[model samples]
Target: MTQTLVKAPFRADQVGSLLRPESLKKAKNEYKAGKITAEQLHEVERQEIKRAVDKQIEAGLQVVTEGEFGRDWWHSTFMEHLLGAEGYIPEQGYNFSNQETDPYDVRLVDKVAYNPNHPFFQQAKELVEIVGDRAVVKFTIPSPNQFFHPNIINGQYKDFEEFAPDIIQAYKETIHEFYRIGIRYLQLDDVYLAVIATADFPPEEKKYLAELAVRVVNGVLEGKPEDLTVTTHVCRGNYRSDYSFSGGYDTVAPIVFANEKVDGFFLEYDDERSGSFEPLKYIPKGGPRVVLGLVTSKTGQLEDKEAIKARVQEATKYVPLEQLCLSPQCGFASTHHGNILTEEEQWEKLRFVVETANEIWE
Candidate 1:
């Protein structure tokens, strides 16, 4: 299939959050220990982000991200920065496969609202300046659905339905602010929907949760600009190469794939844990494109190029080849600890994605 290059969510896209460089990690530790000033730490972050952008372009990726260089946890960093939300240590950490994440989580302390002066705006502006037309700058944040996690302490609202409106309004304003600052491509890193799909809920309960997910997401996208491209990366969890959920998209495919108002779906298909491409049939014809995450970010091993292409071909059984793209299952570093992969291995995996995508789509 001959694919035409469009705006964001390029054929060889990524799920943001790259592995942090040693220098930046050291700076973070120093700042945490009060050995370095906030200004000094930010300086190092700026430098590292610039370098990360250069590497993305060099790796042949059309979309460039700051690698979420300034964040410790991809979701919490942005979530806690909201006007009415704050971070707090939970009683227990999130349990993943043989791993437990830090007990940190975000909660609403009052009515949620977008904070225009959120530091992410400045970070997006800096990324725009650094890229300078060389490639498209894509900004990523956690989905409003993420706030519905059971681990999150909901201090303001009685339930998700009541909490939905405030978060939806907050995200709507936030998206506009991103557009004002020159972010044309925005992706919501979502682990909630995927996690729910794996839950042992009754049929009606599952459907109810799925419908709520669509409502929350579509609400935020109610009146987004025509030019701004928004995509959602449905993740199952990514902490130190450990995952929290395991199941197919069967439960939520019909609801989310058919209703969520987004330009594309960056679905994870790196392993059997994500299930078959059969669920992808729920994606209506000419609807949002499906970016097939054929590469794995949890490990350093590079997949066979031909085998990856074969998997893409296999997915065409449900979705047309023209409507499909390729990327890693998730980000290399979803948190500050980073995945169990060397920096060189991470680049090699990305480069493989670019080369393989070109062979299949170009």
Candidate 2:
């Protein structure tokens, strides 16, 4: 069989389609309304997390994540939770492509400061203990590059170039911290890497950013144990019923695919927005494997089984079938408010992935 989802479950308050029963929602509403303390919200999350973990294992997934349960948003949740991060509410253009975006520039409060007290760092160390065996515990962190990616400095950057030094340092430390905590399957969520690779940026500029991303991420892996399984997920975007950046992997191509310092590449190929499978050839013929996100997490609709099989077959033309795997194009949800899909609908979609894999590989 091909590769399986290294981590398949979601966490409580995770950025996916899993639900927290109405009771917890009602409690959260009360908490937000000033009737309860933060402790109440924490209490609910703790209880709900256990239930989410149980449900994931029951579904037969072997690699389970906390579903980013404690995180608020997917990309920058870890940033805000960091010690020195503060919001830089901007008075400017939108950060994403969708118009429904709420305008408020929430930039990192600090330019640089690595406080050693990140909750996810500590939480991940304990996550495996709570995950309850039979599945490899997995965790997703923003790519080191994104941590220091200079954004619109008044609509551009003081210098996207200036971000390089700090990006390297910050990511190096962040990665080691996870390794120290005993993390094994670490998935670096890298949207920006693919974005710059495909954008109209100058060739030198794109190469610089790609090289820097690899430098920082790989630098973090410099002295790691061989057992570490590092994977990267190149998502277009997943927000509150919104999509972020969009472009085919064709833009990034073999550069981002071959450059990332990882064991696998989770490429989003759910729809036309993801482009064709020809780019799969850019992936080094015998390097890391590719997890084809043939199943999509954007909606509840399951993929046609025969069609997905055919697509997978087509992909083997570029990369060997044995080197391929399956998964939802992106996280079912990448924010506290997940995409508009029922929980049952989400399960059916995942069931399709598992069933499809069973037929194709087993």
lDDT of 1 by residue, 219-277 (tens): 99988999999999999888899888889999899999989989999999999999999
Candidate 2 lDDT by residue in tens digits, 207-262: 77776677667766676667777788877777655676767777567567777657
Q: Evaluate residue 264 in candidate 2 and report its C-alpha lDDT on the 0 to 100 scale.
A: 82
* C-alpha TM-scores of all predictions: 0.98, 0.87
Report, for every candidate in turn, its global Cα lDDT versus the true structure. Answer: 0.90, 0.68
Candidate 1: residue 320 Cα off by (Å): 0.7
RMSD of each: 1.4, 3.8
Clashing pairs for predicted structure model 1, backbone only: none
The parts of candidate 1 lying over 4 Å away from their true place are 1-3, 150-153
